[model samples]
Target: MKSRDYSQLMQELSEAYAHHSPRSAAIHQTAVQYLVDGGSNALRTIEPFPPRIIAARGAYVTDEDQHQILDFWQGHYANLLGHNPEVVTRALSEAFANGFGLQTGFTDLLQVEVAEMLCRQTGAEQVRFTTSGTLATMYAMMLAKAFTGRNLFMKVGGGWHGGHLWGLKGVGYHEGFKEADSAGLPASVMKEVVITQFNNTEQLEKDFHRYGNKLACFIMEPVIGAGGLMPARREYIQRARELSEHYGVILIFDEVISGFRYRAGNVAALYRVQPDLMTLGKAIGGGMPVAAVAGRRELLQLAGSEHGGKVKFQGGTYAAHPAAMIAAKVFLQYLIENETQIYPRLAELGAKTRKVVTHAFEEEGIHVRFAGDRLTDLPGSSLHMLLFPYQEGLELSTPEEVRNPHVCDITLSEKVLQLALLLEDVFIMHGLGCTTLAHTEADLEYLGEACRRVARRIKPYL
Candidate 1:
């Protein structure tokens, strides 16, 4: 397949949106005022000129202009049960009637219930709640360091844990590491972090040999979520487990994205290798802000417990808020009850979507790839040239290309952009299925139709 002129296509797309709807214009204006200083939280995944979503239901979101869009993004893969699921809403409503926030007693039984369920699911004897994934991982790392009497921790290259300084420092995106994603992280902090290339067992062994004693823990995502949807090989994960046990270094599976979606537990369940600690987020709260660090009781007992007369502190005001707990409990119950049927259905949908998408791209003469476990998958389609567009006289690419390419862009730029716009429009009307428990086979058809529409548009370009 020949490469597309993404520069020219993007130029035309920008012109097409020059006179957007008044609602979209208003949203853009408001966003500029409200978010410009702080910036979008997940800026890399969103479009440069993102539409302001006014409302959402199931798998579709309505923009400020009242245009509905099929939401494959799914709140950065958090909405496993889909937007405003009845179970979540009902739980939230009941919990709100009981109370919103109280600093006093445990008025919520759901929190404990969910934690117990997690323990059963993940094989962790104990669990601690946090408000965000970052906090969960931060606590996990601190606990590992304290328990092991070591300061250094090994992390995988191109993997993202969260925004916490220590966690972010462990990521390979910083200076001195292979690639640093963020700036302002102190150089001193980066030095304590040891990073190894993903999927390379030799490097893992070498790092362990060099710094095994100094390392407090080794943290990684079972499936690389933010770094790219790269699933760790089973053998590599087993090796990590063995090395951690041999070195007395805590093994932490940062399943913030992989938890509950791929299997009931962390990817450890699939590989039959249990880590000392595991961090969970995303679907844990069923779209609410919740995260957790679960591990052996001995490790978790250090929280607020005197270990040789020293106490480890970990607390947050909203750590176990009743509303969030209730939502999580109901969501988890639904998941547990329907595990047999729901998981397989989602897997089937994912497989079907992947197959159809792969075939569509092939037919369109676009180079692309699809990746995911049973529940979800990501398409990394891109124009191979965009990686070095400037080398071929093309200085810029589409807003999405600047962020993430689908697989390849061999089709004509104009046609590809048009197809994207058309797909966005179609998604607005029919409401694409997210492959949630609520979504039927018909919904999958809608999703396929959306893909087919885009495929047809790029046929000529191919």
Candidate 2:
């Protein structure tokens, strides 16, 4: 087994995925006429085609073909309470019945409640609402720039801040994290944005030293999500704070996937590293579409005023839709009240699943290294990283070390394994998952069994 045949594995996974969702394959064929690439998002892809999830409940999603897949992605890492929790569903139903859904012409108390909760949790004096993580981050960055009176941005390489213009650099870099990520991005925008390696203090120092004067903000996640489930070292965070303070630059934490991810989604607070400004999403709405940018009152005041002081920030038509705000209020209030129960359970389940999956891989002679395994283990975070080493003896001594795409290139393998596990009736996204309150010991058992079965199929390659 010099190297397990990737082609054969891909073919097997492809056939299995196609076999599991005949209706999805058929509908996708029709969908291609309207939906680009037969899907709305890039991560919706699997081998051959993607499945149409007709309905979901708890930890399972049913495909159009009547197959139940045990989901681990959990609504793109937002469904911390699991899919359609009874409380949220009941609340949503009532709100809809009361004509609170869609774009209500009048403002609602739900928005105020959710925003207040966010402010309390993240220590932000003011908060603004949005419908997506990208929007929240865009506003956060813009506010940072306006407050600091700077023109450039600094960010962690491989960090995903959204599809917005300023956060696009260094995301898909193969050679350097600072390289231009997208093709159509303006050369000037690329020049204005600088990328630094996560947890790499020297790079942080260098970037801050050079760009500090013109740097609008240093935006990053306390725990990396798409770039890698890598967590920033405390030393790195401290150094970033020092540099930002010295240079009068705003430090913004994109807590989209991390907020309440651990406890109430304020990941920066867990490490006692308070960001100057922070964005919240995902779990905050408990599967609903909601996001927010919150921070110092002084910086936030620069947005939406009669005089239009420095920054101009405001929500869109559907920015704080009543339905989403209602759902968010219910979700956030529930977490705040049951903080002890939910956060600890999430941490426990996360650690247990990691162990179960890792043991199965090793037992089958598979070489896997979970990036940010330790970081996601913190109090309330439940992000799961499945890192398969390119070779057997690779060293993954630090979080940033494993974030390197070359050393831990699971691009193809992640697809293959994602499908392979689907064949085992377990659903996940590129081996990335977040445990929720809905996940149980039985779910973990089922997931571990699925991993073992998939590992058997991939034993040769591992």
Candidate 3:
């Protein structure tokens, strides 16, 4: 049996995506007049146009064409309790009715409550709120530079901190990860940011030895997202802590994806490695727009007036909006109280999903690797990404390997499968996305069936 061409498969899937999503296609045509690339976020914009979502509930999103697509994106992996969960929404409604919600432009008790919860749960001595992960990471980098009196920073290849100055390099998988992720970033500043490989302790040590003095911080994700769902090896994390301390480099864990997704707090705590600074978002907000930088008191205080505001780390206009604070506080309280039951169940579901989906594709002779399963010393991970191996026996540990086009089928997982799954009325990001509390065994079964059907179509092209 001769295999079909990859381009042919993609063309068929794109045509199907456009045919079933006519309204979305039309909306995208109109949207291009106002929004760049027909969307605001680069991730949300799908090829042949993305589905225009009107409403979301539980594990499904209602598209403009009134299609109920089972969603694995889950509000950019923030909706731990699912879209508009009653626990957070009900609290917001009550707060609004009592005239205590929305942007107050003033300090409120809710902010303090949420901040306290974050500090206590994550072992942070202090915490500050911001509006997005980008701002949280940008401010964290600035704070690190202020504390260390250094201009340089380090990040792993394929790690995405945000669209900030320090985060714009070493993100996408270019040859050697040398290309700038954006155009506007100053070349001098970009040069200061060195790219290291995830879980490669030898390279990490070499880079630290070379750039230790001038580097302000080493920022990375414990459980890698976007670039790959790869989890950092336990030894790698310990070595990073040791090297950062020895080199006077602040270690910042961008736990925005792994923060509450693993447990009620940050995944770093599970590794038993405390970073100097940690940026959190996604699940922390419970679907509201909230992000925070939490760390040692002295470093954070650099942003305070007493220190002459060396960092100037305050968030912009809608930072810590009263409603977002209340939502976060309520969400954290619920997670804390139900920690034992919630996490174990998510772990069970995640394990089941990985197994079911993997078996479904393998039955069709499709080679796939799922990256977000429980790693050494870190358990209860619910997030996932499907990587199609480009060759037999290819290691899937590091982002360098994961993003390398020669090592993995980047287009197959990132595009072709996504569009095919959408045709099955399912939405996933990167590949197979995160499993939230809203997902059920039934949902897993549905996803398995969808994969089996899609694999049948894609197998011919393999």
Please tell me which predicted candidate would have the highest lDDT against the true structure.
3
Q: Whose TM-score is higher: candidate 1's or candidate 2's?
A: 2
For candidate 2, give the lDDT of residue 22: 78
Clashing pairs in 2: 259-265, 260-264, 260-265, 261-265, 262-380, 262-381
Clashing residue pairs in all predictions, respectively, total 15, 6, 0
Rank by lDDT (best first): 3, 2, 1
lDDT of 3 by residue, 7-56 (tens): 87888888888889899989999999999999999889888789999999
RMSD of 2: 2.1
Per TM-score, the best of the predicted structures is 3
lDDT of 1 at 260: 84
TM-score of each: 0.82, 0.95, 0.97
Ten contiguous residues with the weakest lDDT in model 3: 371-380
**Residue lDDT tens for model 1, 1-462:** 245445554555445554454566556666668775324665321232555677878877787777766665566677776688988887777656886634454646767898999999999999989888888888898888888889897888656788877667534333324544568877766677788755667878999999998999999887765444546666678899999999999999998877888655565787788989999988888888889999888888788555652425454877877777877888888888887876776667655655554565556654444322221222221101112121223312212222233332323321343336533453211011134444456655665565565656545544
Report the alpha-carbon TM-score of model 2 versus the true structure. Answer: 0.95
Report, for every candidate in turn, its global Cα lDDT versus the true structure: 0.64, 0.79, 0.88
**Candidate 3 positional error at 319, Å:** 0.8
Which sequence of candidate numbers ranks them by TM-score, best first? 3, 2, 1
Model 2, C-alpha of 141: deviation from truth (Å): 1.3
